[model samples]
Target: MTVPDYPRPPFKPQQQSFPGKTDKMDPRPDHGEDSYVGHGLLAGKKALITGGDSGIGAAVAIAFAREGADVAIVHLPTEEKDAQRILELVKKAGVDGVALACDISDPELAAKTVESVAERFGRIDVLVNNAAYQKYYESMEEITLEEWTKHFNTNVHAPFNLVRLALPHMQEGASVINTASVQSKKPSPNILPYAATKGAIANMTVGLAGLLAEKKIRVNAVLPGPIWTPFIPAGMAPEEVETFGEQTPFKRPGQPVELASAYVMLAADTSSYTSGALLTVSGGAATL
Candidate 1:
């Protein structure tokens, strides 16, 4: 049979959703939701995470919850259902979890949400800027003006707004983590706009690290490789989905669970001295 998009040990079968789902996706994401062990590293902290509905954001929420921090999730309407599930998971981990439904593409919505979360939590100690959007094209000819702007708005503009709005409310020990991609390290013909924005995120992380140093705030970026996230099923060729991580040395896509540890480290004082760096988690692919 012809290869299918992102088959685990079998063919694509019939279970598929554009952008996919952790709850509905067969062989659901291995989030290790039940295995996280928090040592109160982030105890009493209040954190805001954008796109906290699924994948890395969801994993980070679970980790942060276990670490004893109340979490606020900022997500779009399409992500509302997953965001609700994430709140439940976070509460189960024993931390306060609130889901805010708003179009992150709107700058005012971001400011208001962060402001309210900061007010309710009394202070914001950690901010995770992890929202993203991607519209792939086979060639430049296939990309439209509207798609180009949408890519920048969601992928870069939203995080930029979050960082700006959340910065003032953050404390001395606050941390800001941005979601970048391995595509930032190299160009992909199939995802020009996505690769461009991810690269911008990487550079922006470094720039913010330097800019926020005087405030004692840290900024960093995570460069994820081919992870089995919903973004793939929703954003790429069907054939590409079938062979998601074949190019990686491991011959398989990395899981979201594998990414939470570093996040925990960076969030806590464990990586206090580290800032403006890129953490690569791409199944052995080297960073740029």
Candidate 2:
């Protein structure tokens, strides 16, 4: 199938309440519903992805399935619509896809989610920490302590919790991929708390890679720039959304499908020697 042209925006002004719905976007974000073609790179793998309900997580789930992995996705119950859509696409790859609804910010629940997936799959071959929470704020004061704490809980601590529980179930050749962001290097003042959490994620990826190296478990991260996803509509101001990816050298926001290849590469045997690496899919944005 021919890939659609990368959208150069003059995007229509839009906004959605937090945790946006994929179907509601004016020009729907593509999750390789028609473009990506896999090559059996991850065949027979058992994978788990957080935030697999939409955006990059959904794209990765679809790609991993196409590459022949049975996938289990963790998402909020409210996102059942999006999760169902992703699982349907995964099934097209002839692999089973299950969506587990639970708040991963709760460490206890996060641990249980990993255990449940491991129990179902027998073992986990790939762990993708792709879920995050972010909302724009005018100033530091605008970010309440509760909001700041929630940001760390969801973006930073959840990954730690899941990894701790999953480590025992992960054997040699297992891979853990965290979704870091360009914001980790280029901090955005308006989203200070979110950026801080991303910085922690990037650092955590490096530390975990070294700590887990003895067990031969590869740990890495993908740092994405501005990608066109429901996250933008739900998290940013309408004016910011209008020109979302314009600042990047590519003059366009990346599609979620664009990041799937990097993910597949990291999860596949090809990257066995690659760990503590940050694969940037930032559409030409510089990272520190």
Candidate 3:
């Protein structure tokens, strides 16, 4: 397919870490904090979202809260403003929220993170494994073993640890949402490790859905295309960030709010029969 020339928007504030910042982001991300209407779709439910400090995760946290679910957000220790803002956003929605600072890449900490969520909410009804990392290299030969490990530990293994720990607390009707990337399908030149981990996520989603069927838990994945998130500004050059998502058919980047509906739909009872599915919001990178 011939990729179109997607337009660029006005510049905004951006973060330099994983998940990135929304509050300071230029023309701040549209989180649908005002537009989303809740009909008690998630009344009294609980959700634990890693990387919930900003980007799509922050958007999901707010949307879940609006739908009547109290939420717990786990983010890297240094992701301060984004973490604090998400707390306020959730609280503004009239739902409880907690910002946990942890290194999710740490297996011990990932376990502790899940336990913390279980303790806070009494039980976890939803788990959104949305944290990820990537480092660009000019060529495949430039990739280092340490960099590869970082990608796997951050993207794939952490989610697995969290899910394993969360399982004992989650019962029937529970859902696990893993944030896979468009890289899993559409190849990129400098992101081999990130792409590989994403492919593992796709496989894990299918495998988990099959294994957890008797437990009545649903495991699914969300494939996000180039969204104007912190990952862009932090990982890409200033010029690259300026032109992020320009290759998509949408002609521009998708905002965080654009993904709120999908997360809410997946979390709510509406998708009762949905499982082993991949929800693609890839700016038309591939069809559903």
Candidate 4:
């Protein structure tokens, strides 16, 4: 299919508080609501995604449902409206769908969320660790210890905890997909804390792939570059948001729907031989 002409910047200047609402975005992100079509790639599978309320996670949820997987998406309590909308789309694909409200930064909460999903689905064939925390800071002095820790907790530690908690439900042929970032290799000083966490996630993905190889499970990560999502407005300055993805050769940020197929390919049974891979989805940008 021909790629649709996705919106390009300079976007209308906008800003939002942490955990931005989808309805608030100017051109809005496309979570494959009308475009994505499936062909039973994951029929009868059960998958769980963190931060599935908006952005990449939501798109993956929609794609997974269309592909015939039962999906449970995790989101913060404050994102219920967005979560519900995604869940509605998921169910519309004629599969089981649920929205789990939990702050995965807390180990206990993360564990409970895993247990709840496992109980509801009976098994987890796919785990997508997509939730993340990021905020741009002009200098190191502007980043506090609390903010630094929050980044690790939400981005790194939470994925680690979820993997540990969800493994029991995952068996042979299961897949684990982490959302690493181009920032992992090409770090930006402004969001150093977030970049650092993504670096850790990329490393963790490789390590876990090795460790889980004996169990016949595949582990991988997707390093996305400058996607147009609620994350931009929420984590960036209004001025920065206006020109979000101009640095890329594409001259625009990607839409959330654009990353859907990467997640689907990683989770599908056909990719059984794929593991320890960091698939970069940046539009014409190079990463180490």
Candidate 5:
């Protein structure tokens, strides 16, 4: 996969409401529908992924299933259509696939969703806290207290709660992967709240890795740079979307499929020695 093969900047301007749909994307974000081939690295493992309806989470779900893991994906009720499509793809990989409509910002609801996945899978071998919420703001004054709280609730508190709830079902060798971002380190002021949550996520990942080391369960995070996903169109202005990833060294936004291998590696037993690591999959952009 070369830079030219992927969609580049100056793309056709487009926009969508929060949590956009895949079908509406101009180039249609690829979730490794055809490119990814698994090696049974995670055979018989059971995995749960938040926000598995689309974008990076969706790609990871597909990769996990193809690698022979039973997958349970959690999404919002409004994202059921997208969730169904991903579920079908997962099932096609010859593994058990389940989808739960959940608003994980609610701690109680998140706990219940984790319980259902644990019960269905018999145990949770891998937990991917990949769901997130963000909105564009021109200034701190534009950010309401309610919106600020929502960011933490969805991005920070929810992941923490899921980890807490799933811990009982996880055993030694299980993996926890959080979706931090380039913003965690190199934040943009426009989305300060979201950036702050990501910074917290990165910090939490390192702390959790240390805490879980005694339990032998690894904790890590993936820090993705600019990527062509529903989030771009949904969270930014149409003009900004047009030039989406132009600043990257590759001069193009990464496809969701581009991040699948990193998630697979983290979840695989081969990475047993890897923990508390923040793996960055940016298009040659500096996270520090």
Candidate 6:
């Protein structure tokens, strides 16, 4: 079946009470299941992606696998089914795929996840620190201190732990790609904490790029506008979900596969000079 292009909302009103389980999605978000074609851009590479069971991480896993890379994804234990599906897709590409289950917010578990992957693969070529936690709040009173701290722990601290643990396994020519958001520049009132972490990720990408340049490791970020993923309907209201991407100039949200090429470029050898860059994959969402 041909997936329709953007500008039209293509899904029904469906929601998952919790994150993970891509199969529960209404339209079953397209992870280039039949469309994305690879060209050996990342051959012989080993990649570790947090939250790789679904959404953008799943899309990247499939793309990297097709391009000839062995993939190790970290996801919550509840996401085993979704991780199984991604593993199947990676295997189809004739590459190895391993899925590790753990809550990345735990610094010790996060470090161990990276170590396991590095041990299995011998080294890490790509590290995508994409796992995040988000919740909608109407007012400052509605947001608890624990909630705020949890967001930082999962969204910010987990990335830091993973990077530190993986750095020793990363050599020259390695790439670290972070998933930032259009919210990084333009904050959405409802999801303040999530947006704040995205801003931090973008800033860290630039600073880390310079820090890692001496080691010849590239650090970059992808600033996505609004993509049609479980994150949307799961986080927003039913009415908001119905009109999800209407605010964008494209009048629709981007698909997971649409952002695949940007990730591929950053992870590939061709983007060796593309460190510290913020590649916006927003469908006409304005970014400064």
The estimated TM-scores of all candidates read: 0.93, 0.98, 0.91, 0.99, 0.98, 0.96
Candidate 2 regions with alpha-carbon error over 4 angstroms: 1-3
Error of 4 at 241 (Å): 1.0
What lDDT score belongs to each candidate, Candidate 1 first?
0.82, 0.92, 0.83, 0.95, 0.94, 0.87
Q: How much is 245 displaced in model 5, in angstroms?
A: 0.7
RMSD vs true structure, all candidates = 4.2, 1.0, 3.9, 0.7, 1.1, 1.7
Tens digit per residue, CA lDDT, model 5, 39-81: 9999999999999999999999999999999999999999999
Model 4, runs deviating above 4 Å: none
Highest lDDT: give the candidate number: 4
Candidate 3 residue-wise lDDT, 1-288, digit = tens: 233233355454344654455554665566666666677889999999998988888889988998899999999887877789889989988888899998898988888878888888899999999989977677878888998999999899989888898999998999999999778877577778888999899989999999998999999999888887767776665666766776777767888777877888888877889999988896786633
- List the pairs of residues colliding in candidate 5: none
lDDT of 6 by residue, 140-203 (tens): 8888889889889988888877888899999999999999899899988888998999999999
Residue 146 deviation, candidate 1, in Å?
Answer: 1.4
lDDT, ranked from best to worst: 4, 5, 2, 6, 3, 1
Among residues 3 or more apart in sequence or in different chains, the pairs in candidate 6 whose N, CA or C atoms overlap within 3 Å are none
Task: List residue ranges in candidate 5 displaced over 4 A.
Answer: 1-4
Candidate 2 per-residue lDDT, tens place, 1-288, comes to: 565787788899999987898998868888898888888999999999999999999999999999999999899989998999899999989998899998998877787888899889999999999999999998777999999999999999999888888899999999999999999999988889999999999999999999999999999999999998999999998989988899989998999999999999999999999999988899898878
For 1-288, candidate 4 gives per-residue lDDT tens digits of: 788998888999888988888999999899999999999999999999999999999999999999999999999999999999999999999999999999999998898999999999999999999999999898889999999999999999999999999999999999999999999999988889999999999999999999999999999999999999888998888888999999999999999999999999999999999999999999998777
Clashes in model 4: which pairs?
none
